[model samples]
Target chain A: MTTTQVAPAPPGTGTDRPAVAVRGLVKRYGGRAVLDGLDLDVRRGECFALLGPNGAGKTTAIEILEGVRRRDAGEVLVLGEDPSLAGRGWRDRVGVVSQGEGAGQALSVRETLDHFARYHARARSTEDLLAAVGLQESAGSRVGRLSGGQRRRLAVALGVQGRPELLFLDEPTTGMDPVARRQFWELIRGLRADGTTVLLTTHYLDEAAELADRVGVVAGGRLVEVAPPEELGAALRRETTVSWLEGGARRSVRTQAPAAVLRDLLAVQAEIPGLSVTRPGLEDVYLRLVGATPTTSEGALR
Target chain B: MTALHATPAEPRGLERLRWAVADAVAAAGRDVAHWRRQPAAVLVAALFPVLLLLMFTYLLGGGMVVPGGGDYRDFLVPGMLALAMVFGVEATMTAVVTDTARGITDRFRSLPMAPSAVVAGRCLADLAGSVVGLAVLLAAALAVGWRPGGLVPALAAVGLLLLLRLAFLWMGIYLGLLARDPSMVVAVQILVWPFAFLSNAFVAASSMPGWLATIAEWNPVAGTVTAVRELFGAPVGTGGGWATEHALLLAVAWPVLLTGVFAVLSVRRFQGLSR
Candidate 1:
């Protein structure tokens, strides 16, 4: 992993305008509201994650922002212009990776990227883009012949090939293995360093926590919470649990202050065996926000 | 990285046209790539019409009397050309249905290309594929001693056949977009088979019963097949009344009308895609 951190741009270095802004957005399908009056703002050069379960309107919101679907009612300003009425120039400034596999299965990896590169005035070189996505070896392989993870990496490569100012990636790593997922995260971080603003929706909670500076949890078509991962968990911080083994029997207790509990236990037992204080993680906060039991992973956010 | 190649200053109208053309070409190129990967399918589609031609000319050619006193092979060739056009509709429909089923259409919608590029490109590529299929069928007919009267007439017949293909392509496009599943396309195609078989493609409309003759004579497929027969110096029945007299005009008009109506409808449907 590259440890060098790119310094954040000075305040007011760029105009204080959002790359994507939506307010009072509503979308309905067959009289059922899929997105009910949702509001969001993604700043320039930030990786913002929209976290939600399936059917929570995450895909619908992203589709409307990409100008691929029309909202029933809303004010959407993508790059300072309404995407519904925006012209070709506005499209040129944005990049989108949809949920499906792209192009025909017969096209070679290089041919696919090269073909898309023609659509933009400025694009990354096909070679460098392929190398960045770790597809340099499969450049001549047919898309269908590549593995599922490779195809996904190619999809992401195509999304960013145009060097778009704003990019929408919906479940970009849905089928990738853990190593590939980590490599893709690094690639996304590199894009942020290059001044690209990204809006993403993912099923992986760890992905959201690791990649997103701020995460928004959406439930039942409404955004319920928006905050940094640590801050989100901060609310459950006081209710910590101290656990240990006594007389060869495991014991656990919830307390407001774990330090006091541990101090008193040590005074009696001299050195408590297996003493440990545990706090809630981002997963705990996420499960709570979505109204699910945190202990069991089943029926949690997908 | 080629240093981003200095953005060229392009004139506005020219730039717009250039982008549209590029998008169309890219789409066509993708279709062709798919065809290359599945050459067996193309070969099979091209062979069906040729086999029909040989069987009709050899087994049924002897006792049949062509209205214009010409070779049965010549009469069957033009109608076979029309059948080729009809048959290619399945390919178009299948392509559209496959794209929808695989979610490729949604992916294309998300791209920044011209709005009409996807459909336009698919139609154009299908048209080109049909032309190739027609040429192969023609080559097989020539080998079987089927020749048109002259080069001019032959080229004119080819043009009319292409118009018919374009008409059916739009119909296929409309149906392909409307059908919910690939199996629905198969069912619709089965319905069209009866229309294709009952037309003037194989036998003279005069041989049919009165009620059936009326339906076959007025059938749009019959109109095209009859018109192509006249253009290529093939035998079309004379006793078919006004339809035989104005077969050429009707042949040209059917495709024009169908193409115009369906193209407009498809474009309108495309505009409403955001819903």
Candidate 2:
């Protein structure tokens, strides 16, 4: 948080710089603002998860940071350069795994990686990249024939082939099976271990809890709250629920003093059956911030 | 912790050019692989003009005659060659639209590659395919008793045909970027056939009505058709007026103009995607 106060320097000249820093970013479509004066900062070597509901300007903010969309007003310094005007040198340092297919349908996995490798000055080997993404077996298969998970893996491979310092993953595991998703988490963990900065956007709250060092919740086109997952839950005023079975009926009470309630219950009962204490989890805090009904399936916190 | 690596400096000057050319060739190689994998589609694209040549020469040729008292096959062969190049617009448009719909174009745009390399690669691939397609049509014409009078003019005629194809190539790219999907491309393709037939590719412009002939004579396809027919020693009717008489000038002018306009439009549309 202290790092954001420092003024951004010229491209490639800043010391102790955040990987991505934005101040008062704004974007509009036909007089309606999609990104309305938002601010965010992602420190180097940290995995920052941006969580938001649909139409909450998450994609717009990410695209502006990636230099794919022009922001109407803002001071954005991504990797020490204004992304909107960054040259190829700056782009080489960043990688993006978009929520879209790769560039070639007829091209095999190897061919596709090789083609993208040429874009960077020091690209990783296609063989190693394929192995990293677990697509070595499908290296010879056309992209059109690969399953959805395989294609997503291929997209990640292409993103990291340049050994980028910053990687942007937008809904990276949308169609992957549970096992594949865990495997992807391990891959991202490896990238983080290598000191690569990752900025992730996902609807999955568990994913955000599991991967992010800090989570920023965006709603109504602005970041309403940002903190570590536990802190985000603690910041919310939701009461802890203490429940137990007493006299053949279940009894429940919401209270801020759940610990005292549990102590009194324990002092009264020699053996209390089916006793449980439930505090607000990350999902509850996220739902509260986004102003959504907890029962809604769309953009589920889980 | 894994070691963090800094991005290497960008390639400068000659090295940049080397990388750009290599990337462009890589893109073209993708088209090569596509052709290898889908040889059937390539064959169909290459042979479609031959079917048109045969249908016109055998079925429609019997009832039609050249305006200047010559073989309809001779006039039709050169004109069909020009028409074949024009017909390639649909194929190029279809490929571009498919790429866009499939999100391939957007992927390419997100990379750090040379901005022009992808389009350059696409143009090179389609142009190479057009050249081969022209050769196949030429062979069919030769088998049907058409002959070139001179080598130099024939080569020049081929150049003009390819130039015309290149112009359509940009137009296709522009339309492809504008189109929503392959279905939209199909809708546009239906219009290409009707547009192709209205030109002076089959019959002489002079043989049509005064107003129709004037419009047909001024059709960009008419310039290439007339220019190629003249170069191939086929009968070119005496369609008067500055536009028809100066067919060669228009042949060159039309492609250059179209290329200038549509290439700008394509690049603008491409760059505007981010905006």
Worst 10 residues of 2 chain B by lDDT: B1-10
Which ten-residue region of model 2 chain A has the weakest summed lDDT? A293-302
Q: What's the TM-score of each model vs. the native?
A: 0.89, 0.90
Please list all clashing residue pairs in model 1, or write none if there are none.
none
Q: Mark the regions of model 1 whose C-alpha exceeds 4 Å error after superposition.
A: A1-15, A241-276, A294-302, B1-14, B60-69
Off by over 4 Å in 2: A1-15, A243-253, A259-276, A294-302, B1-18
Local distance difference test, candidate 2 = 0.83
Model 1 TM-score, all chains together: 0.89
Candidate 1 is graded, for docking, as: acceptable
The residue-by-residue lDDT of candidate 1 on A136-199, one tens digit each, is 9999999889998998899899888877888899999998998989899999999988888889
Candidate 2 docking category?
Answer: acceptable
Give candidates' CA RMSD values in order.
5.9, 6.0
lDDT of each residue in B1-275, candidate 2, tens digit only: 11132234556679778878887887787787778888898999899999999999999999997776888999899888888887777888888888777767766766777777878889989999998999999999999989998999999999999999999999898988888578887777788886777778998888888888888888888889989988998888765567778999999999999999999999999888877
lDDT of each: 0.81, 0.83
